[model samples]
Target: MDKLLSNIKIEVPPGIYLKDPESSSLGKKIVENSIILLENIGFEDFNFKKLGQLIGSNESSIYRYFESKHKLLIYLTSWYWSWIEYQLVLETYSINDTKDKLIKAIEIVSRTTKQDSKYSHINEVLLNQIVINENSKSYLTKDVDIENKDGSFMPYKRVVQRISEIISAYNTSYKYPLTLASSVIESALHQQFVKIHFKSITNCNDEITPTEFFIDLTLKTLTDGK
Candidate 1:
């Protein structure tokens, strides 16, 4: 899988950036340090100037890649989902049974992220943390409608659609596959957030994981009427 992924490029919408960050060393440095800095300071406190200082580049150089911090966040989130989508496809493609495929897909998306050595510059674990803690800010904007039209969120939507198709295949009679698919993905992130900050409100803890919860819920919901 690592070998195959080494040859693959995680595509983010070109519209989100003024330049491709993966094309050059400085660009990669910008992305690499931006992730570390964003995880350290968060989006609200994160800015191009701070990232410039961390990367030893001018603030204008950062803008040469991303137009704004919001766009950078979108780029990071998009890359994260694209990475997950690749794993979802590669891991679940060989399963013959529909239910088994759906379950595997759920696990791939809902499971906690670990670092992948393939992309040495970008840290998948920190990127996952950003996705869990700061993902909504990427699209929850007045410009979201315009951005959606521009395909800025395509990677995320593709993951949901892929899982939704598997759900429909597992249970043809299921009336809300899309809703359920999106819920599973979104709820997994939310559950992780609550587990860390509001433990009293969530069932997920050391003993139980969000992956286990979603898989159980999905199987029950899809099988209940059948």
Candidate 2:
């Protein structure tokens, strides 16, 4: 699986960046350091100048890749989702049982992320943190409709659609597979956020995980507690 993944390139929408960050060493450095800096200083305080200082490059050089921090966030989130979609397809594609495939798919999207050696330039763990905390900012904008039309959110939508197909295969009569699939993905992020920031409000912790909760929720909802 690692060998197969190493050969895969996670592509984001070309419209999101002024230049493709995966095309050059300097571009890759911009992406690698930007993840670390964004997680450290957060989206609100993160700027190209700070990233430039961290990478020992000029601010204008950073701008050559991303036009603005908002677009950069979209790129990061898009890349992360594309990576997750790859994991989903690779891990679940061979499972012959419909229910088993759905369970595996849920676990892949809901489980806490760990760094994969295939993409050393990306820290999946930190990228997961940014997704959990700042994912909404990428789309909750007046321009989201415009961006969606331009395929800015295709990676994320594709993930939901894949899982939704699994749900339908598991239960042909299920009327809201897409809704359930999207809810599980979005809620997984929210559950992780509350688990870390508002622990008193969520049951997920060291013993119980968001993965377990979503697995239970999805199965029960689909099967009506069968």
Candidate 3:
């Protein structure tokens, strides 16, 4: 697991970004600093102009890597999915029992993320915050069809499919594996939003962790037992 995470260099879809942000010194700075920018200011206020100033580079240099802030957001989100998927596979791939695999898969998505130094260019903490608060904006937009057609969402979808396959292995007779998989994925993200914004309604706290909530719900939903 340590070896695999240490070797991470996730490849984003070609159409997702203008250039690979991990390719050069300037590009790496763009990826590293942009996460900071997005974290400090909300996505609505984030743009290449501000990012360029922050990185001590010009707008054209930043634009050379990303066409727009939307694309940049998509790229960042996709990179995150790819990285987490790597961790997911590393942690769960070797398990022979389907139930164990399914449980481990749920754990990967439900826990709060800690930044891995293997990918120094990306700050996992800020990326997770963006995912909870801003990532839906990338796909919830009107241009979703165009981006989907371009395969920009493939990394995230791949994560869903892997988990869905685990469900099918757990219970071939059960239906709605893919739907359940997507639900767990989206719900895990939204639960963070709920915990932060709707604390009065949520029971998530130090006693009942986000991970415990999802593991209980997912196992019961998958096996029809608590």
Candidate 3 per-residue lDDT over residues 1-226, each given as its tens digit: 5785577578789998778877799989998999899988989999999999999889999989989999999998998888778878889967999888888998898888998888877899999998888879889999999999999999999999999998888888778889988999899888888988898988986677777888888788867722
Candidate 1, residues 123-155, lDDT tens digits: the string is 999999999999999989999999999999999
Best candidate per lDDT, number? 2
**What does candidate 2's lDDT look like per residue over 91-190, in tens digits?**
9979999999999999999998988988889999999999999999999999999999999999999999999999999999999999999999999999
Residue 211, candidate 3: C-alpha displacement in angstroms: 1.5
CA RMSD (A), model 1:
0.9
Query: Which residue pairs does candidate 3 place in steric collision?
Result: none
Q: Candidate 1: how many backbone clashes?
A: 0
What TM-score would each prediction reach against the true structure? 0.98, 0.98, 0.95
Model 1 / residue 133 / CA error / Å: 0.6
Where does model 3 exceed 4 Å of error? 1-5
Order by lDDT, highest first: 2, 1, 3
Better of 1 and 3 by TM-score: 1
User: How good is model 2 by TM-score?
Assistant: 0.98
